[model samples]
Target chain A: MIDSIARPTAAIRARPVLGAASVVALFVALWMALIWSPPDAAMGNVVRILYVHVANAWLAYLAFVVVFLASIAYLWTKRPAFDAIAVASAEIGVLFTGLTLVLGSIWAKPTWGVWWSWEPRVVTTAVMFAMYVGYLLLRNLSNDLERRATRAAVLGIVLVVDVPIVHLSVTWMNALHQLPTVLRPDLSPTLDPRMLASLVAMTIAFTIVYAYLMTARVDIERRRQARIIEARA
Target chain B: MTIARIWRIAAREALAERGHPDGFVAAITFVATLILVESLAVGPLAAGQPPVAAALFWIAMAFAAILATTRSFDRELEDDAIDAILALPGGRDALYGGKVVALTALLALVALVGGLLSGVLLSLAIALPGHLALVLVAGVLGLPPVIVLFVTLALRLRARGALVPILALPVLVPQLVAATNGTAAAIVGDATGALGWTGLLIAFALVYSVLGLTIVPTALE
Candidate 1:
C-alpha cells in the first residue's frame, strides 16, 4: 500500500507542470473570446465577457460533480487518492464559483443597474460559494486527514443541492435578476455560430485541462501522503 | 438484526437524551430570544408594511431550528453513544435515519408549541396562521440535512460545538430560503407557487437519508 503511493510522488516530480500549458492555452482562448469577439447591441462588449463568466459557472458544476463522485469513491473504496481528488476538486470548484460571482457581479453592474440583488439565483450562488468556503474551513480546522476526508466527503455529496438550487433560483426568484435567456431557457444556442463554436470548444478545452490538473494533483498528493507515512515510520 | 429492532435501538438512543437539561433549556431560550428580538421590530414592521413579515418570521424558525438540530448529535457525542452506534455493523444508517426522524419529531413538537405562541404574540407583526402547517412540514423536511451534518461532525470532531453552526448555516441556506418562502406564501394566501419551495425541502431530506446511510459508516470509522 505504501510503496505504490510513494511511487506516484517521484512520477509527479519527473513530469511537473503537466497541466500548466493546457490551462494557459484555455485561459488565452477565453481571453480572445471575450476581447476580440464581436459585441451585441443589447449588452455590448460587456456581454461577451459572459463567455468566460458562464464557462466558469459551468466549470463550477463540473468541479462539484468530480468532488461528489470522488467523495463516494473515497467512502466506498477507502482510498486516499479519492479523498485527495475530492479535496482538490472542491478547492478548484470554490475558485470557479468565486470567479463566477465576481465576473457575474461585474456584468450585473453594467446591465442590471445595481451591484447586488436578492434574486434566488444570486442568493443561491452566494450560498454555493459560502458552502464550499465552509467546506474548506472545516477541513482546515480538523487535525486528522482521515477524519477531514470522511466529514468532507459526506458534506460534498450532501451539498449537491447548491448547484441545482442556483440554477432554479435564477428562473424563479424574479426579484431583480431575469431568467436565463441563452444557455438554459431557450436551449436553442442563440449566439452567433462563431461564438457558439468558441463556447463549445472552450468547454472541451477546459475539460481537458481539468483532466490534466486532476492527474497532476492526485499524483502530487500521493507523493506528499507517502512522504508523511515514511516520516512516521 | 430486524428492521424494527434496529429502529427501536435508534429511537431509544435518541429518546434516552431526555435528561439533558441544557438542550431543553437552550431550545426554548433560543426560540424565545428570537421572538423577543422580532417583536422589537413591530413598530417598523407596521410602519413600513414591508410586504414580507411572514418571511421574517420563518427566518426566526430557521435560526431557531439550528440550535435544536445541533443538540441531538451533541448530546449523543457527550454520552459516547456514537461510538457504540458505529460498532453495531450496518447499524449506523438505522441510527442515522431513526435519529433524524426522531429529532425532527422532537423539534416539530417544540416548534408547534413555541411557534404557535410566537405566532399569536407576534400577530400584530404578522398573521401567519396558514403558514403553520407548511412551516411544520418544511421544518420536518428541512432538518435531515442539518441533522446529518451535525451527526457527521459530532462523530468526527466529538468536542467541537462551535464549528457545527458555522459549517451548517451556509449549506442550510437553501433549505432556509425554501421554508421562509413557503411560509411567506402560506401566510399571504399565495400558496399557488409554494410547491417548488416545499419540494426543495423534501429533496433536502431525501438527499440526507440516502447519503447519510451510505457515507456515515466510513465517516464513523
Candidate 2:
C-alpha cells in the first residue's frame, strides 16, 4: 500500500525550496534566539529556550485548530481531502505538543526545582497531549476508510471542546506555574523588544515548518487514497 | 413519546442486566479489590486525610466505570443486537439514553460500595453524608453519557477494549477533578465548596449528555 502511493520524485523535487526555506528560517531563528535576544533579568540563558518552546506550543494549538475545522468540513462534505488534512494536522499537532511538554520539563527543572509538577498548565497540557495521542490511535482502529474518517471527525470535534475546559479547570485550580505574560485578556506586550522580535521570528519559522510538513503529509495521503481507489477499480 | 421510548429502552437494559449481571458484578469486584489494595498499600487512612480518600475513591470508580461500559456495550455487539437496534426507529437516541441510565445506576452502586468500604476499612469519615451523596450523584451522573458516546465510537474499532479508556478518560479529567474535590470537601466538612464542585459536575453532565445525544448517530455509523 505504501509503495503504491509513495510520493513521486518530481513532486519531492518541486518542494525542495520549501524544505530549504524552513531549514534556513529555523537556523536564523535559532541564531537570533540564542545570540541576539538579551539574557533575562533572573533566568539568564535558560530563558532563551522560551522562544522555541513557546513557539512550538503556539503552533501545536494552531495545528489542532486546523484539525478541528478540517474535521468539521470532512463531516459536512464527506471529503477525503478534508479528512487527510485533519489527520495530518493532528499528527503534526501531537508532535509539537510532545516537544512542548519535553521543553517544558527542561524549563521546569531549572525554574520550578522539579522535573514535573501538577501545576495547572502542565496538567492540562499533559491531558491534551494524551487526548490527541488517543485520537491518533483511534484513527488506526478501523479498516473501512469511510467509517474511520467519520468516527475520527466526530471525535476530533468533540475532543476539541476539552481544550478550553482544560484551561478553565486549570484556572479554577490554583496554578503553581507563572501566569501568562504575553497572551492575556490584555494584549499589552511585556518582553524586551529584541526578545519579542526573536520570539516572533521563531513563531513564524515554526508556523512555516508546520505548513510545509502538513502540505507534504496531505499530498502523501491524497496519493494513498487515489491508489486505493484505483486498485479497487 | 420519545421520553417513553427512551425509558422503555432503559428498562429493558436494566432487566437484561438483572439477568446477566456481568457488568454489575465486575464493577463491584473491581471497586472492592481497589479498596482492598488501597487499604493494604496505605495501611489505613489517617483522620485528616480526606483528599487522599477522595482521590482513591474517584480512581476506583473511574476504572470501574471503564469496565462496566466496555462490558455493557460488548453484550449488545456480541449478538449483533446493536445493529438490529440501529435499524429501528429512534434506536440511536434511545440506545444512547438507555445506556446512560443503565450505566449511571451501575456506577452509583459501585460508588456506594466503594464509599462504604473506604469509610469502614480505610477509617475515613464522611462528615457530611448528604453532601457526600450529592457529590456521588453528580459524579456518577456525568460519566454515563460521555462513556456511552465513547463506547459507541469504539464499537467498530479493532482494539476497543484498550481504546475506550484512552478516548474517554482524558476528556473526563474535568469531571473527575470536580467530583474528587467535592468528595474531599464533603469528607472534610466543607459544605460550600462541596456544593460548588457538585454544581460543576452537574454542568459537565449536562454538556456531555447534550453533546453525546447530538453525536451518537454519527459515531455509531
The residue pairs found clashing in candidate 1 are none
Q: What is the lDDT of residue B191 in candidate 2?
A: 99
- Residue-by-residue lDDT tens digits, candidate 1, B68-95: 6666666766778767877776666666
- How well is each residue in A8-119 modelled by candidate 1, as lDDT tens digits? 5543564446466566768777766776567876887776766777678888989988889998898788788888888778888898899888887898889988778776
Of the candidates shown, which would achieve the greatest DockQ relative to the real structure?
Answer: 2
DockQ of each: 0.54, 0.78
Estimated TM-score for each candidate: 0.85, 0.93
Predicted candidate 2 versus true structure: per-residue lDDT over A17-112, tens digit per residue: 778888999999999999999999999899998998889888888888888999889889887888888999999999999999999999999988
Clash count, one per candidate: 0, 0
What iRMS does model 1 reach?
2.6
What is the CAPRI rating of model 1's predicted complex? Answer: medium
The local lDDT score (0 to 100) that residue A165 gets in candidate 2 is: 52
Clashing pairs in 2: none
